[model samples]
Target chain A: MEQRKATIRTACVEALPLAIAIAAYGLSYGVLATQVDFNALTAVLMSVLVFSGSAQLVAVAMLAGGAGLTSVLLTVVLLNLRNLLYGAALADGLGPAKKWTSLLAFGITDEPFVLASSRFQKVGPDPLYFAVVAGIFYIAWIFSSLTGALIGDHLDPQKFGLDLAFPVTFAALLVPGLKGKPVIGTALAAVLMALCLEWFKPGNELTIIITGLLAPLVGLFMHRRSDHG
Target chain B: MVNQWILIGVLAVATYVSRVLGLTVMAGRELNPAVRLYFNYVPTAIIVALIVKQIFIPSGGHLVLSLPVLAACLAGALAILLFKKFLPSVVAGVVVGLLVRYFL
Candidate 1:
């Protein structure tokens, strides 16, 4: 029991920083949802149900851009392909939870994936830790969206630099993980692939998915070559 | 709009299925080592792509660098490397980005 407490406490402390960054995006999502004519209830409800930062934000942004439902769904599907990878990798860590795995799977997005994977790596499986981290992020996302919706169109997101939070938050999460040659090679490859995709057809929706699928091969090759050498 | 709600519902279900499928299907199985390594590397690849996507915006069919976004991302990356903290790094990045946006 004492060990469980320590695990939960550690999870919370680790999850807190990313949760703040998630909240910043949540607030922006709420405000954007409203701009796209989503009622405050719907805005908050979307956060309640979906709990995904990228999908929710992109859904609203595409709607605001006058994208149709089919297009939005297709794009969201592309964005969500990574979740399968996250879920698969997280499956073992969450296996002991049994029925609870379904409940925990909701937290299988990027930040939780990072936090949970690290914890699992360090201490082995601990569903309690995953639960704590997911719970904190869930509360942060839901409430922040509500706050942003209630604040409504009166405030400007850009003026306060809410827009910058997305990339900056990602950068903060990403930089810590850039360890070793293979990983650095993978990131650099991803950058090049993304830039090339964007250059070819600017704002291409497939850039992330394609880059994600392809870039790591470069890292794999580099890893193999270094091993042989 | 009713359309928005329907879209939300579709998205919620689709997203949940994607999230749950992997956990359930792969839970007990031991994956191939190479596959496991690839999965481990996937997040970094996706994140780098995401950051890059934001920093470069296409305008009139040409790629242009958004200096503020690029600067902010660099500042945030540097801050995190220095402090090993999340919130402060984000704040530093956003503040620098905002200054660039307003002053430039």
Candidate 2:
């Protein structure tokens, strides 16, 4: 129990930076959801259920564009497809556990996965600790969205530089993981895809899905050829 | 009024479907090696993708040539990478973004 407490404490401490980013981004999503016609309940529920920052951004954009239900579903599913990749990486780190623990895997996100997977290598995969981190971030996100939704369109986040939080949080999460050529190539491809897609598919979430799916293929092919040669 | 509620309900279910499908299907399985390799690297790809969009394109068809945003974000990344301190990096980025938005 003492070891468990320590692990949870350490996980929470390490997760603080990501927690702030999630809260700030969630708030923005909630406010935007309201402006896009979702009421408070729907807005909050989306954040709790989806819990993906970029997908939520795309969701409101679709809502604003009067996208049909099928289109919205396709767009959101594609935008968040990366979470499957995230979940797959995370499953290995889950350690020896029972079937019931799988419930916590549903709440997995970028921050918790990174923290848990990296630490699990050393800590031996405490599901309780991972669950604690996920729960903290999940609560922070839901409440932050609620706060922002209630605040409505009055506050200017651009003035407070909230937009910058997304990039900064992303950078902090990304840089430490840039280890090799294939990874760098994948990043470059993703960047190129994002830029090019913006020209044609403005506000569409499919760009993320396409870029994420393709970049790794480019990386893997290059890696294999280079390895053989 | 009812129409709006209906739309919201549809979106809510759609969003839930996306999330639940991934979680339920992929949970408790060992990832194929190729997919595992991709997951390890894709986070960087996703972040770089988003960052490139922000630095080059700020609005609809309007490019902001604001060097401050770029410099600040770079500085923030550098600080966190160097010191492993996230809050300071966050402050650096937030300060730079606000300064560029306000003064520039």
Candidate 3:
């Protein structure tokens, strides 16, 4: 019990800044969802359960566009494909955790995952730590969404093009990580897929799925070829 | 309203399913070296794709030769060069973007 208390305390201290940044993003998302007419309950639920800002933003955009259910689902799934890699990489760290650890892992979004993964390596596996960080993020997201919903549609940011937050954030994230051909190639593949979808029959979400699946394959093939040479 | 709920449900399930699938495939095992190497670059690729689509091509229909967006990008680039912090650069970009929109 003392060990658990120590773990939780350590996790909270580390998770503080991440919780703030993530909460800010969630608050912005809540504001946007409310402006788009999503009820407070729906908005809060999505943030708490979906817990993926990129996927949720894409889903909301498609919803505003009157996109079909199939399109929305596909877009979200494609956007979240990276979580697959995140989950896999994190699996080893979770090896010593209890069976109930999966519940905490469910809340492992980008920020917490990075922070938790880094700390988990140094401290050894601790489910309580993961739980503490995930819980903080989950609560922040839900409350922010709830707050946004209650504020109603009075503060619409779309007119100012604030709807571009996702893309902007993604852009900022992208500029730093392009170190090699593998990264460059996958980005090119995604761009090509999006362009083709936009210009041609408009595959909507399938474009994301296709690109998400293919980009990694391209990276794998390039790595193999480079190895052979 | 109901549609929003539906979208929420679909997105939640889709996100969860992908996570579950990933966890299962890598369950109780170390990641393949090849796979691990590629995973290192996925975040960069995803973010780049997102930014290109968002900042460069705001309107879905066409890529406008956007001076304001370009200016904002430059400002953001400078912020990054100076501070080396992601949020500061982004905030700089957004503030510059808003200014550009308001003035020009």
lDDT of 1 at A24: 78
TM-score of each model, paired residue for residue:
0.74, 0.63, 0.77
lDDT of 3 by residue, A112-149 (tens): 67877887689777667777888888887778667756
Q: Give lDDT tens digits, candidate 2, residues A1-229.
A: 8887787788789888788977876766666666666667877877776666655665564444345556555555554566676565556556454574556765666677778878877867577777888888888989988887886555565666655655665576567677677887787788788777766655455555567667777777667777888
Model 1 ranges with Cα > 4 A deviation: A1-40, A53-101, A107-133, A148-153, B1-3
Q: Give the number of the best model, judged by TM-score.
A: 3
**Top candidate when judged by DockQ against the true structure:** 1
TM-score of chain A of each: 0.72, 0.71, 0.80
Q: What local distance difference test score does each model get?
A: 0.81, 0.66, 0.65
Q: In model 1, how many backbone clashes occur? A: 0
Model 2 misplaced stretches (Cα beyond 4 Å): A1-43, A53-105, A111-133, A147-154, A161-173, A197-209, A225-229, B1-31, B39-43, B58-91, B101-104
Candidate numbers sorted by lDDT from highest down: 1, 2, 3
Clashing pairs in 1: none
Please tell me which model should have the higher lDDT, number 1 or number 2.
1
Candidate 1 vs candidate 3: which has greater TM-score?
3
